[model samples]
Target chain A: MELLLTNLAHGFGVALSLQNISFALLGALIGTAIGVLPGIGPVATISLLLPITFGLPATTAIIMLAGIFYGAQYGGSTTAILLNLPGEVSSVVTTLEGYKMARNGRAGAALATAAIGSFFAGSVATVLVAASGPLLTQVALSFGPADYFSLMLLGLIIASVLAQGSVIKAIGMVVFGVALGLVGTDVQTGQQRFTFGIPELSDGIGFVPVAMGMFGIAEIILNLERPEARSVLTTKVGSLFLTREEFKRATPAVLRGTLVGSFLGILPGGGASLAAFGSYMMERKISKGRHLFGTGAIEGVAGPEAANNAAAQTSFIPLLTLGIPSNAVMALMVGALIIQGIQPGPRMVEAQPDLFWGLIASMWVGNLMLLVINLPLIGMWVALLKVPYKYLYPSILVFCSIGVYSLNNNVFDVYMTVLFAVFGYMCSKLKLEAAPLLIGFVLGPMMEEHLRRAMLLSRGDWGVFIQRPISATLLGIGAVALLAMALPNLRKGKEKAMAE
Target chain B: MRINHRDVVAGLFLVLLATIGLFLNMDHNLGTARRMGPGYMPWMVFLLQAGLGALVIFVSFGKRGERVEVVKPEGIDIVRIVSVLMFATAAGTLYLTQYGGVRADKVVTFTIMAGAIAAGAIALWIRSPETDGTMAAWTQGEFVAFVAAMVAGVLAWYFIRGAGGYFSQGYNAVGIGMLVGFLVLAIPPGWRYLGLICACMCIFGLFLEKLGFYLALIGTILLACLAERDHIRKPLGVLGLTAFLLVLCWFVFIRELDIRVNLWPT
Candidate 1:
């Protein structure tokens, strides 16, 4: 406890510096603004800024980037509430109740609940990082090729379950993503795998190009096509704040989301996006008034918002301790640290206590800053609905392209982004949730890399996935997810009668 | 309108690509009898893609041609979007390649490229009266603001931290202080542009090593021009010309050449 307090104090000292604070504010403001724009997400934003962050000190850079990651979650809810457009995939749950609340003139309540819930979650997750640092570090250090592979397999299965859709489609997309990941040069053998003889392909398809294309650019194109369909709520803005009753209802959801998300976010292959969706679904399942769902339940806004923020904060635990990125954004953070000549692992805490502690402490400060900026700006953000959609949509596309191109100084990425933008739009049109596809994309490469590594280590023994304790545990969880998915079908008869 | 045709087409493309890929993988002599070869992964990827492609097609287009309902853009709207994108790409390329010192056999490569793109876009907008194209009218202010931005970008490059002649190591104490001052005072419309400038600065050192001193300067401008232009055909044209020049130079040095031809337009 003394060590925790001392570390927290030192962290405050570093984070409270005027410069660091200013950077945090800047990151939050920028992150929130971009996040409010549907389809331009944190991954594209971070990839764009990765090269620029190389010039800053490691801790300051991470503080700013991490701030953007969580701040976007806060901002994503704003769009969901007002426009019925979930800016981030995880924020889709927010759309069910958030937009309904807006239509019912409870927009302010929804916004407030989301913001406060996020803050609460972020605060708790920060503590988790501080407390669980050592144990997570042990998990990080002991991971071998086999362990890593099994963990990723578990992650893939969990991600598929997290994607609320046909399990087969999720599996298909995961396999597809793994195939795409194999396009680059083979690691062990110095031979190009799927270049199609294009000089650029020899290095394989770059992640930024594919990600930006599929998610960022695709989102813009889809938005433009549906400009007429978007119904913006211009009804009464309500109290412009969360009422006492609203607070009482939201507190429990926020706490539950925080706990669930923080724990899940710490696990490898888990991210804030997945945690957010998981929390939102859990909230719906537990809510007394299930019929009120999808029409703007306060719990919907509160739970997912909390989960997303907490997951964003707790995601750093694995990275700070184990050097494993829970998602692409976290991967970008690892890239930033590597550029700063800092290898993230168990010894990082011992070697650079100030950096670790300072980052953790700064997350709270950033959350506070976000709330300060967001609460009052809620009105302004809603008023933005008045703007003409034609202008709004184009700028979104431009920003997405700019963000993608900023990654590698390569125009090829922009072209790829355009391709993905169309694909994403098509997916949306088909009622195929892009979230599952993304989950697959994010986990596919990690799964393959680990799988190959494991195979090499175990000399082709497939049982390696179930041999280790941690791996076995993770696999067990995966099996349970699969079983749970099937349980609904088995109980279908009883469930129908109960419903009637 | 019904089934998601876009998905069907995308899935079909994937299947076709996978088939071709599978054939190529079989042709590669990547491994021997003792060890797994590099072709192994490619073949695995091919099969996986083919399988997934088939599944996506079945899910999306099966069940008696049942279609997935989707929102779609009109033909004209798509054209407008494509045009705007083309303009942005062209502008970015021109700005990066022309002034950023990317070497090429041409002068004012960025300006020419941007003009071509802007001209085409303006023409397209004018042709489509029904389309709002957003802007009420192309005003002097917009033009002046654009010119100023371009000039400012070039100046930023000139005074960048690592451009040398101004600051040691391109960004020593004085350079960083100046950069901060510039940022505070100028505040470029987009921070990404500023980031790009920093990139231009950092890559300056590498350019020095790759290209001879004189050529590096030229190459920087060429690259900057390409960065500003949308599609890179023009810059590639310049690069092609340069390659020709290099080949000629080789001929003169080793094979002896009496023929004289300056393929570069500039």
Candidate 2:
């Protein structure tokens, strides 16, 4: 405990540095701006900014990226309250009570509750991370190659099942992403697998192009296909501070949300949206004002907002400690770390204590910065909504083109981006989700490496995975998850067959 | 017969890709599964993709499957697609001839291939009758004539450069041809501005290093501004906004950060 406290203090020393603070503030500002905009999310925003962070120190870069994430979470609720439009998926629940509160002339109160609840959750989750990150690392350090392989398999399966689509299609996309990840020169044999004679293909498709193309460019295309819808804001934004009674009602809800969020956030495939939904359900079940659940209830606004923020922070635990990303945003972070020449895993804590701890400490600072930045800036954010998307889209396109070009100063990457943009559009049209593909792509190579290493160690004995207790348990969990995903589909298939 | 068209198309595309990948992997050594080679994983992936494709196709044949209606493009869409393709080909040719160190003969070969493909595409477009009422016969005739002239000019430039031993000068001829082509092609009413903006972006990328940042950006903004339906009426406003954005980009990306890019053509 003393060592942990010492490390955290040292982290604060690094995070509070002028340079780190500036990056954090910048991230928060950018994150809030994007979060306020409908259809733009943190995943795309982080991927877009990934190239820019290549020059910064890893610790500063991650601190800023993390800031952007949680800052966007806070910003998402603002839009939810003001526009009745959820900017990010996690804020969908907030829209229920938040928009109602805004309609009831309690926009300021709702915004304040969201901001305060997020700050509280962010602070508590940061502590949870600091406490559990080291412990998780210790457990992860004991895992062998087979254990890692099984764990990754489990993560991928869980991600596929939890994705918002047909389980079969999601699994297919994951496999497809894994294939895409296998494009470069094979590490073991030094023979290119699918380069098709392009020299760039020998190095594999870049993460930035694929990500920017799919999430950024494709989203722009999708948005442009339809005419813009005017956003309606409530006329009166009364009283930024909550009433004494409202505060009393919100405090317990926020605490419950933070606990629920922190716990769920550590589980694989459990992201901000799930946390927000879970907390809302829990809040509704226990709240004395359950009858007013959907109608301007402070508990509804506080719980989900706190839960999502806490989940957003604690989701970092898996990525930081085990090097296994639980969701797409964390997967992007893993990409950022790899670009910085730091392989994220158990050794990260012991090898780069400063980065690990500094990032955590920066989260608390960033949350504080959000509270300071968002409340006064609420008017400015609302004003920004008045800017027509037509004018904004061209600028976004130019930025994306420039950002992608700056990666390697090669036009081939730009062409690849165009290809992926088309592919991304096709995915959307076909109702396929991109998140599972992204996580699969990130984990594919690592999974292959571990699988190969385990095979070598066990002399190609397939039974080796079952012989090890931890590996066996992980594989068993994966099997159960696979069965769970398959059972419902199988039942549906049988029902259809019988009907026919 | 009543299968979901979207799933069928997607499945076929995946199957084709996997088959090609499988064929490509056949030449590489496939070591045992324990000690895998370069081809091992790709082979497995191709097989998996093929299986998934088959499964998707199978599911599409189910009774409750949703059939997708593929919307056919109108005359303006064809024009936009062809013009964009032309711009990309010319730009790619110029970049390769100038910086990629391609031989003059290879440039000529590529230009011929691109011209042939464009000709085929134009033929296909002509075969497809216009569905929109706005596409008058005269307009179609004018569009076809403009496209043919543009293609001829580009091909003539390639021949002149190839035969006249002035490979570098071919770029100027093609650029002129494209500019004239764009000016001559009367845009149909109610066309989406995104198409024109996309074309402008292609041109901007092509000329980014050659025309310099300021000139390329100014030209792109000018062309992109024309994409708006009201650009003719509100010319000055669009111009001013373009100038402002140019300066902003210059200050942020170049001046403040000192990015190592050429501000002016060398």
Candidate 3:
């Protein structure tokens, strides 16, 4: 505990630097702005901004990116409350009671509760991350190649299982992404696999283009296909303070949500959306006013909002300690870390303590900054929604094109982006989830490397995976997950949960 | 005879891609599973994809599955979309060859010209009054107009081939072909607007180095604005917004960040 506190104190020293603080503030502002814009989530925004962060120090870059993430979580609830639009999937539950609260003229109270709950969750989760990061790192250090392979396999399977579509289709997307990842020159044999004689692809497909194409440009085309109505409540926002009764009702819910979120966020493939949804379900079951869940209950907003923010903060635990990305957003963060020449893994804690702990400390600062920024800036964000999407979409397109082009300064990347955009559009049309594809793409090469190493180390014994206890257990879990997905009743339960 | 299932079509596409990938890597050594060669993983992946594709197809045939409703477009709409795609492809090919160090020769130019003519012919055929059940006389007039537009496109291509260092002959031919075809066929206003915007984006990518940042951005934004329904009614406002955005981009990307992009053509 003393050591952890000392580490956190050192981290606060790094995070409180003027430059780091500025980066955090910038990330929070940008995150909030993008979060307020319906359909443009933090994943796309982070990918869009990834190229710009290439020049910053790794610690500062990650601090900014992390800020954007949780800041967007906070900003997402604003739209949910005011416009009944969940800007991010994690905020979808917020709309259930948040929009109702708005209708009942408790919009200010709902917003405040979310902000305070998120702040509380963020602080607690930051401490949890700091305290548990080293423990997880130590656990990760004991893992072998076979164990790592099985764990990644389990993560990929869980990701596909949790995808919002047919499990089979999601699996196919994952396989397709893995195939795409195998494009460049083979590492061991110096031979190009699928370059098709294109020298540009010898380095493999650029992640920026693929990500921006799938999430950014494809979203534009999808949005264009459906005309959206922006129906925002224009009434005066009431007091930002919650009533004493409301505060009393919300505090316990927030604490419960933080616990639920913190626990789930550490598990592979459990992220903000799952945590938020799970917290809401838990709240509905436990709250005395459960009947008022869908009828302007402040606890409804408080629980999910806190859970999502906490989960968003704690989701970094796996990525930071194990080098395993639990979700698509973490997958992108891994990409960012790789670009900074920092190989994220168990060694990350000891090798780069400042980067790891500084990022953790910045989350608290970012949450505090969000609370300070969002309350006063709420009206500004609402006015931003009034901007016509017609104007917004074109600029977004131009920026995306520019951003992709600027990566490697090659127009071929831009063309690749267009191709992915078309493919992404087709996937959306088919109701295929793109998230698993991204996770697969990011983890595929690493998984292959680990698997090959394990095979080589075991002298080509296929039983090596089963012989190891951890690997065996992880594979067993993966097998059960696949079996559950194949079973219709469990699949229905999953879909029901997803729908909620 | 009638294959209406979208899943089946998607599966078939995936199956075809896997087959092609497998066929292309047939010669590569697939070493033992222990010491996998370059092709081993790809072969495994392709086979898995093919199996998944088969499963997708099988599921599509299930009794209680959701059927995807495919919206078939009108012939004219198909013609317009195909023409745009063809033009974009031609431009992309030319850009790839010229800038990306691909071999650009007579065959490449010929292929581009052939593609342009095919796109133009499709546009003319789809726009023919006979296809729409109009009078035969009008159909004849449309055919004449199509021929005249083709001739004009060819003449423009011939005249502009040696005019400037900025424009390639292949790009000139494709551009003239697309413009003439669009004018002769008189594409629906909405589609035309979208086509122009897409074309501008392509142009921006193709000429960002040659045309520079400000000019390309202004032109792209201007064309993008045209896609809006109210752009025709508020042209000045759109133009003003374009100017304002160009300035903002210049200050942010160029001046503030020193992004290394030239403001004007070198």
Q: Per-residue lDDT tens digits of candidate 1, residues A143-193?
A: 876676666666566666555444544555565666666666777676776
Number of the top-ranking candidate, with DockQ as the measure: 3
Real contacts recovered, all predictions: 0.13, 0.28, 0.37
RMSD after CA superposition, every candidate: 15.0, 6.8, 6.6
Error of 2 at B64 (Å): 6.8
| Runs off by more than 4 Å, candidate 1 | A38-57, A103-105, A196-203, A264-300, A318-356, A383-385, A400-410, A419-449, A479-500, B1-17, B27-36, B54-266
Order the candidate numbers by DockQ, best to worst: 3, 2, 1
Against the correct fold, how does model 3 do in TM-score? 0.85
Model 2 vs. true fold: TM? 0.83
Per-residue lDDT of model 2, residues B1-266, tens digit only: 56564565456555655665676667678788678777777788779878877777677777643333322433446655666476547645664665456444443345444544443344333323333343222255554554554555455455555453332442434443443333443243322332354445455555665667777677767776665555668888777778787887888677754556667875
lDDT of 3 by residue, A1-500 (tens): 99998999999999999999999999999888877876678788787777767778999999998888876777788888888888778888999999899889999999999998999998999999999999989988999999999999898888888778677777787888888887888889888876756788998888888898888877776665455544545655678889899999999999999999998888788899999999999999998668888789988999998999889989899899989899989999998898788998999988998998899899899999999999888888777766677677777777776777777777667667765875676576556678888988888788778878998899889899999999999999999989988877787787788777
Give Cα distance to truth, residue A459, candidate 1, Å: 3.5
lDDT of 2 by residue, A176-236 (tens): 7788888888888788766755688898888888888888877776666545443656456
lDDT of 2: 0.75
Most accurate candidate by TM-score = 3
User: Per-residue lDDT of B116-219 in model 3, one digit per residue for the tens?
Assistant: 54434343332222221231112434544545544554555555666776456234444444444334433343124323433445555655776788877877
